[model samples]
Target: MTEKLWVFDTTLRDGEQVPGCQLDTREKIIVAQALEALGVDVLEAGFPVSSPGDFKSVQEISKAVSNPTICALSRAVEKDIEVAADSLRFAKKGRIHTGIGVSGYHIQHKLRSTPEAVLERAVKAVTFAKNLVDEVEFYAEDAGRADKDYLAKIIEAVIKAGAKVVNIPDTTGYCLPVQYGALIRFLKENVSNIDQAIIATHCHNDLGLATANTLSGVENGARQVEVTMNGIGERAGNTSLEEVVMAIKCHSEIPVHTDIVTKKIYETSRIISKLMNMPIQPNKAIVGKNAFAHSSGIHQDGVLKFRENYEIIDPKDVGVEESSIVLTARSGRAALKHHLNLLGFPVEGEKLNEIYERFLELADTKRDIGRKELLSLIGEQMDHSLLVEIQDISYQGAEGKEANAEVTLEMGDKVLTGSSKGNGPVDAVIKSIKQLIEHKVILDEFLIQAMTKGSDDVCKVHMRIMHEGKPYYGFASETDIVLASARAFVDALNKLPIKATN
Candidate 1:
């Protein structure tokens, strides 16, 4: 039988701990709403004792989100539990997440206490939290470093003490997947009342094994995973929410599934990045821009023919409209903006238009306009006087007819105009732009799709060109695919040296 895995998100609590990325109460609510829609089982809002601001944020999120269980973190202490319970006064469902370190190293060095005392404290904490809320979760911090026998002893005590979910964390990210999996197996075997509560995995990423360890734990009987968006947390960060979710998705043979709306993953990731001011590394799995981008000529040609040749998860499955193709020599503003968003340098409005022109000029100088060159271009405050701008565009197409496009462009202070007809709107747009720029280039491929479900939904277009034996890419998003295709055409033309593929 396929079992359901609970996705316990700690973005507001752990993710917010990223330095200089702290969010206030309102921003926390924004993230909470997004998480609710994403279908996380438990939303760990904040540590009530950490700050007055965090306590208030938890309170506000409880009021704002009615779906997921609003969880508040607390030490095993009375004050922490008191504040945690009070913070969730408005939550339709609430959980008091309380626990202490169970490892000998933590007991002796960190807490200056003995194993017996720590076990007693763990029991007392769970009991205390259970009294405040019907749903209580207990975390055995540093369980990775703790003695397996004693860890089982304490975990059993907490389950008997009324913990509905018991978290066993690789606090320092110190354990290998096999070792972590064995520990979870050992606890399941030793704990007498283990069936009373769910075993949860909370692994860090210090050794870059958080996701591996988390999966190992889940495979070994854990039914819950504690994670943060973009993997933002202390040091190397916590287990990535997207990575673990996608792992379960791709490896369905694991026979576990999350209620998370996989389609909301990208949108939620962006929301967290923007609100927390924490840019996700482009190489990060799942929601990263490069996750679905094809750059190399071999890769581009392969994916253009069949996406499954390279992509495992569809970009659209994660709220991204489609995969992106990076230019071999240069890319237009649309591709630039897409890559920039993935690389964490979003620009908008008038600033976007200004940067758009500058990006075209930068493309003229670089062959492959990937992240590194684009970052460098944005860094140098150079002259953007020679770049071209697109305006006065129109497209005409229907379900069973030919397409036509007309466009005007301003290049080097000169206004030029052109019009063309093609088998499709996208083709027509590219043809018109080629006529205007008087450049000999072939439209190798183009992709057009609606980003949302509405009559006026945004349309995203990506296209590739072969110019003088080199390939370039361009993209645009507009209300109309014809206009977006025209924008994409102009984008590709801007990268040309006024010639065709050699």
Candidate 2:
């Protein structure tokens, strides 16, 4: 039988602690609702006593989300616990999470207190919070580095004092996976009342072993995993919720199951990243941009033959429409054929072999191959109705007046014109083009590269446009950078599905 693994998300608490990632009350509520929809069992809204804004955010989040158990963070102090409880007044289900330092280092240096005094305070805090809320959780801060016997004693005392859950955090991310698992096992064996309360794992990622340590804890006996979306937190960040959930899902022998809606993982990650102003690294696991993308020839060939050959989780499982076969210098004949077919130009045998040679030559210059490059490589005539050609462009800029741009575009025999004002010539030109195209697109990324070290040097533009959650790549080069940018945008626009033009 698979035991229920509680997923406690501390994104709004721990994750928001990342400088400049803080959210207002309204934004907090929006995230709270999204987390609830994602099926997190516990939502750590905020440390209510930290500020008036945090308190209001927590209070509003409690009202906004009802499915998950709304949780608030606090120290073991009376005032913090009181404020935490008050902030959850509107929650259908509420938990007060309070804790203190427990390691010898924390007690001696951080807390400036003795172990005995800390133990007494831990019990008192739980007893205090239990009276205010039906669910009370106590954290033994820095438990990963605390003395095993003393840690067991405090955990038992808190559980006896009415803490329904005990959080064991790898505060400095100092413990190895084996050591962390042993720590959880030690408590399971040494603490007499351990069975009365659940043990939760809250590992950090300083050594990049947070996910490994968390899995070790779950395997050893810990039933709950506290994490943050996209692993956003202080310093190195916290355990990734998507990573842990998907790991357990992939390996069913873990004997634990979370309520996380696995398919919604990718979209939720993007929302948190955009709202928090943190960009997901291209290679981060589970929800990163390249998670479902295959570029190498061998890998692309294997994936094209059968998805499971290289991918463990189906792209659709995480809400991605499909896997990406990114064509590059390392890409194989199979990968080239895949993209060619996608662009409506299928080739085989000698024809495919001939294109493969030219592809490798072009791929060496371009990182990613797109529709324009494919058409040019195969010597196919331009599909006028589908291709967008920049006819003319002009922009005016002054010290005080906003920059304005006018652009003329020709597609097949049809000509379209647009004009707009923006902060700069490039911005105005892109805005003007947006008015000419019917596709609702966001320029996700725009990069410019100089071909040489002089003002007369030609520049290359790379643009990534996102339409309906899918990305399209484009590239162009010209002496005029603004014109190159416009051409790049048009190149990417040509790749959008024809329905976008409707």
What are the per-model C-alpha RMSD values against the true structure? Answer: 14.7, 4.3
Candidate 1: pairs in clash: 329-367, 468-500, 468-501, 468-502, 469-502
Residue-level lDDT of model 2, residues 1-502, one tens digit each, is: 8999999999999999999898888878888888888999999999999999999998998888889999999999999999999999999999999999999999999899999999999999999999999999999999999999999999999999999999999999999999999999999999999999999999999999999999999999999999999999989999999999999999999999998998888878877886786878878898877888889899999999999999999877777778878888999999999877866777999999999999999999976666767778888755667778899999998423689999999978889999999877888999999998777998876668899778798999877678887788788999988899999998889876442121
TM-score of each: 0.71, 0.88
In order, candidate lDDTs are 0.82, 0.90
lDDT of 1 by residue, 27-121 (tens): 88899999999999999999988888988999889989898999999998988999999999899999999999988888999999999898898
Question: Where's the lowest-lDDT run of ten residues in candidate 1?
Answer: 493-502
Please name the candidate that would achieve the greatest TM-score relative to the true structure.
Answer: 2
Off by over 4 Å in 2: 389-434, 440-470, 474-491, 497-502
